[model samples]
Target chain A: MSVIEIKNLTRDYGGKGVFDLTLSVESGETFGFLGPNGAGKTTAIRHLTGFLKPQKGSCAVNGLDCWAESPKIHGSLGYLPGEIAFFDDMTGLDFLNFIAEYRRVKDKTRMRSLLERFELDARGKIKKMSKGMKQKVGITAAFMHDPAALILDEPTSGLDPLMQSRFIELILEENKRGKTILMSSHMFEEVERTCRRVAIIKNGRLATVDSIDKLKAAQVKKYVITLENEKAALAFAKEFAEEDVSETRVTVSIAGNIRELISQMNKYPVAGISMPGQSLEEIFMQYYGGNKNV
Target chain B: MFNATLFKSGIKGGIKTLALFCAVLTMYYLIIVQMFDPALGKMVQELAAAMPELMAIFGMNLNSATLTGFLASYLYGFIIIMFPMIFSILSVNRLIVRHVDGGSLVFLVAAPIKRRDVAFTQMTVILSGLLALTLYVSVLGIVASEISFPGELETGKFILLNLGALALHMFIAGICFLSACIFNETKYSVGIGAGIPVLGFIIQMLSNSGEKLEGFKYATFFSLFSTDGLIAMRPNAVWGMVALFFCAIALFISAIAVFTKKDLHI
Candidate 1:
């Protein structure tokens, strides 16, 4: 059984909404939602969380209609918004108690553990807390309930690197306990660590949905090399196909010949050699494009 | 059904504003009732007889000897309506639109409940605050009257007067809450929320000036609670109260319906 399901959900807000997007996460499966900003990741999550009513299709959770039965459907679901805003007047503890009581969860052992694991102090007022601290509070609120299913949008957006890894562990732990989670993020590493199946969306549409192992296997690396002269650049460019070659600089793409490419490039008088992180779009181009070349 | 947790949280959030209104309005109600010495009342009535238009803007009747007319004009006229309207505008807008704009509303509706229930709970909190304000006026009016001038105020007519005022503010609260639900941005919600009441005050003031401006009275929601009917202690203005009740219910229902169907950017 799928814990979260979105089918052809469509809402066109001028130029900023999801269109006919459909996806689902099976029970106990950690599904990674990968997309750039304004790619409708949050919009699709909003639909699953029942914050938005679908325009063309339907969103269901645990076999219940999300729009009409949001109250019942989301009762056992934990939702962490991408941009979190708490009641400014209350302390973090107060907000947590407020949510706990709101959810009617009596036992708070999990809430305390979540707070300790996140290294958060629930004493200070939320308005005075930093953005990162507020995000932690949001995470605590989402995880403390011990929900059956969790829907998180950019869950690690403001956490530090250490905390991000800790969050990945938290998700993995919950996954072991048979909890379903659908997380949206921009970081491939985190998604790679915890999410088994990942979905990529672009321009309000699903670009691709595949397993993490498959995507990582198809990943390509781009290297930029600034040579000593045009002669060296041309010699290096001759070995590799045309990427971008100037008089003294050459950019190259390496798929599976990193060792060979490095050895070949070292023969030249290299001034600067650098590799840039591939964005989601670039990764998609390489992940899908590089396979055809093989 | 209402969410108890949300209802409790809402009341806590609203208590400070509710207390401020109750304190300020209670003091004003006490002072206005205390100032009603017969000699001064005669003097004000005589003075008002000279420039009726000036006193009319404040909604004060010229023929003012009884305590009911005195309290109606001075207490129930201008600042009384203004303060509660301010509370309604701020609180309702804060509860609904600001929650969406600030992104806190995501927590409430995301709970295991219907969107309409969230809307209903917040509306209940707002209406309950408005009810507190009206009830304070009624209870304190009776207690204050006993302390200051016994038998001077007809208790029956006083209750009718307050019921009329409650109906008016309920109607006002509904319109403000509707604005809060319609607009996602706080500024737009507040713009319409505050604008409607201030506009009503202006129109009511103009209408109270004379017959030529009476048409403008109908333009404002305040016209449903006639100052003349309130001062005259006519308990039979059933149509006016009925209109106010229906308008309030209609606007409130529309707000809930819009909220459940509307897409939130959260």
Candidate 2:
């Protein structure tokens, strides 16, 4: 079932080319929202969180309209923004406890466990903690409520490798527990490793939404070869239906059934061959348009 | 549910401002009492007679040119009132801008708390702390008056006058809070909040200069708490007291209304 449904969502801030964005995420699935900076990822998230009312169409979390029932919907969702600012004077423990109290639920044991897992000091003031530690605190606060849906934007931007792995583990556990996650991230490897499906957004519009398998299938694959005999390489190239042929070295584009192409290549006097696997990074780069930062 | 958080934030904000005010007041008192020469008494008396009613807005009275009166003048005029004004400005700025800049306001808005409730809690915190500090100063003033003036000070009348002055400060703080709530931009909010009271202070000065523009008196919250008028202990300051109390209520309600309608920019 779809946990979040955004139908032709449009938001205009009296600015020029922002806000005609549309996307959706299903329940119990890790849906990755991929885009470059200022591509309206945060803007769309803001609309979804009901921070900004949509100028057109509708955004409903679960079945609750974001604008009409924000408070009720907010109670069941955990959101971790791309950048989090904390109360500097508050200790990590105090801040977390305060949020817990505001939510009107007590689960200190889970909070303590999360702190231990993140290797965060509960007693340290937020101002004294490093940026990465502060990000960890944000993550902790988002998950403390144990909401049914999680909207995490750039959730792992500042974490070390070990902590990143732990966060990935935590995300997976939440997903397994049937929480829907809409994560916006630049880290394709992280998305590829965890997200079941991915949505590529370009210039505040939906570019594509496909499963990893489908994306890999639709992607253009490259295979490189070094032939011992130039004549054999030419002969293989003639027999094969691959384009962009060169003398000793050749690169082939394969959409399906690469086994035949590999077999034909084997028939040639090949010294060495390399066929790089299709990565989400390549896919992101292909669709990301002008924002090179992606 | 909201009162607890509101009270906590208010008390914390007030205490910080109170500390700053008390420190300045104590320094001014010590200098006036211990450092001045007795031969300067004649010069002080001459200066006291020339003092305008405008200068009394700062709680300054040259009539009693002694250390205690000097302290009262400073505290009454700008120091005490400035504490609440500065506190309101800073606290409101933190709520509007710092929260937006820090990105924590997003988290707060995304939570179950209503926009109106958030504003209410913040205002409560600010007012509670101001009330506490005002009471503390009143008590401190009673002690200081007893010690500095010996038998000349009437504790009962002095307390009533100070209470009236604190009520006026409360009304000004309410205006600041309402301004902060009405505007999302912190600078604009701070500008109007801080500027309004300073403008009133200037008007009070003009009025003291004896121009017949008593209309300015209606706009100045300080007029309602005029220390000289209250200290006179007349039977007709009831109008001022009623206006002062009503202004506080009206400002607070307006703050809530504006908060409910205004966009949560942060």
DockQ, all models:
0.75, 0.45
- Residue A227 error for model 2, in Å? 13
Scored by lDDT, the top model is 1
**Model 2: per-residue Cα lDDT over A192-247, one tens digit each:** 77798988776677777878666554555678877887776776677765555677
Question: Which has the greatest DockQ?
Answer: 1
Alpha-carbon lDDT, every model: 0.85, 0.71
Backbone atom clashes (below 3 Å) for every candidate = 2, 9
Q: What range of 10 consecutive residues in model 2 chain A has the weakest lDDT sum?
A: A285-294
lDDT (tens digit, per residue) of candidate 2 on B25-140: 56654444444343555676666567754444344565444433444455555665566566656656665546654567776678877766776777766666566666777777
The native-contact fractions of the candidates, in order shown, are 0.88, 0.52
